[model samples]
Target: MSLRIEQVGPASSARLAAIHATGFDRPWPANEIASLLHMPASLALAAYDGDEMGGFVLVRSAVDEAEILTIAVHPDLRRSGAGRALLDAMADVLVRTGVTRVFLEVSTANTAARALYDRAGFRQIGQRHGYYADGTDALVLEKTLQGSGQDGA
Candidate 1:
C-alpha cells in the first residue's frame, strides 16, 4: 500500500519510537524520542500506512549541515519504498532550511540501509570503530545538496 509522509509532531513520538523499536537491534526509549522535539533545529518525518506508522527519519540541522539522527522502517514493511520516501521528505525539509549537506552513520553490517543511502547518492567519507553498543563499526556517509557541493558532482 502507498504510504503518506507527515512532519512528526509532539503526539507522534510514541508511534515513532514504536517503529524504531520494531526495526532496531537496540531501540531508543520512548522518552528519548520525545526529547528530540526539544532539540533546536531538529525535524522528523514519519511515514504512515493509514493510521499506522511505517517508518521515520529524524534530522538535526545546523548552519550548512544536517545529520540524520535516525532512520527506521518497520521490519515487515521494509524493502518497499517507505524508507526512501521518508529520507526524501526529510531532505526536502532540510533544503528549505538552507542545509547544504547531510551526514549520517550506519552500522557496518546494515548492508540494506547502506545500499539505500548509496543509491540516494551518499558517499562514504569515513568510519568510526566500535560506534555501536555491540561493537560494530559505523560508516559515515555524506551527501551534498544539489548546487551546494564544492565539486558540484
Candidate 2:
C-alpha cells in the first residue's frame, strides 16, 4: 500500500493513455491526453507502487468547483487501495487550488466505483439516463472539500 501519488505532466500522457486503455471502452488517445494536460485549470495525478503505475485521475476546475473528467486504475490494481489513494490526493490538490466542491459521474451499474465514492463522502446529486454508449444510466455525485482555499503547503 505504498502508493505514491504525484502530479503528472504532458510527458506522461502516453503512459497515462496506455493505463487508461485498460479500463475504458473508448479510451482517450495520447494526443488528447496531452491536450488536456495543457488546458488551463486542468490537472492530472498518477499513483505509483514504487515505479509501477497503479492508476491516474484527471480533473478540471471552474471557480470553486471541479469535475473529474476521468479516472482509471489498472484492473490488476483494483481493490489494492490505489483508487482510494488517487481520490484522496485529488481532493487535497483541489482544496489547495481553491476548489471547494467536486463532481463526477459513475455508471449506475458500477457498484465498485459507487462504493468508493460513497465511502469518500460523495452524495448522489443527479442522474443522467442512458449516459453511456451502452445505454447505461449514470449517477452524478458531488463532494465538498473541507477547509478549502488553503495554500498548497
Candidate 3:
C-alpha cells in the first residue's frame, strides 16, 4: 500500500472523526479535532492511501516535551503500517520542533498498539488505573530522542 502522511486541517475534521470512531470506542467529536488544529503548539497528521484516510495522530508540544493525544488506524487497515506511518510522521514533527521526548497513554488491553510503541523505542513508564471511560487502565509510554551528536555520523 502506498501510504502518505499529511497534516490534517479543519476541513478534514469530519472524515478524521469518522476514522477515529471506526477504530476506537471513545472517538473524538468532529468539532473536538477541529478545535485542536486552531490551538498553538499542537499538530495533527492524517495518513492516507491515495484519497482514503487511513489513520491519524494528534500531538501537543511544550518546550522540549511532546505528548501524543491520539493515534488510530482504520479498522480495516490495522497491521498494514498505516499507524506506524502516521506515528513516524508525528515524530518527525516533534523532532523538528526540538522536542527531546514524547509521551502517550494507551489502553492496557491494546496489545497491538503496545507492541507497535515498543518497536518504535517507547518505554513503559507507568499505569493509570481506570483511566478510560469504559474503566480500562492506561499504560503510559515515553520515547526519548537521541541528540544529533548521539546518532554518530
Q: Candidate 2 at 58: error in angstroms?
A: 0.3
List per-prediction Cα lDDT, in the order shown: 0.85, 0.89, 0.84
Say which candidate scores most in TM-score: 2
Candidate 2 lDDT (Cα, 0 to 1): 0.89
Error of 2 at 51 (Å): 0.8
Candidate 1 stretches with Cα past 4 Å from truth are 147-152
Writing each residue's lDDT as its tens digit, candidate 3 over 1-153 gives 899888978888898899889878778999999899778988889888888888889888999998999887888789998887777777777777898888899999989999988877788899999999889999998888755312111
How well does candidate 3 score on lDDT at residue 6? 88
Against the true structure, what is each candidate's TM-score? 0.93, 0.93, 0.92
Clash number by candidate, in order: 0, 0, 0
Q: Which tens-of-lDDT digit does each residue in 1-153 have in candidate 1?
A: 979998876578888888889878789877888888678788889888888888999888899899999999998789899988887777777777788899999999999999999877789999999999999999999988854232124
- Tens digits of per-residue lDDT for model 2, 89-112: 899988887788899999998899
- Higher-lDDT candidate of 2 and 3: 2
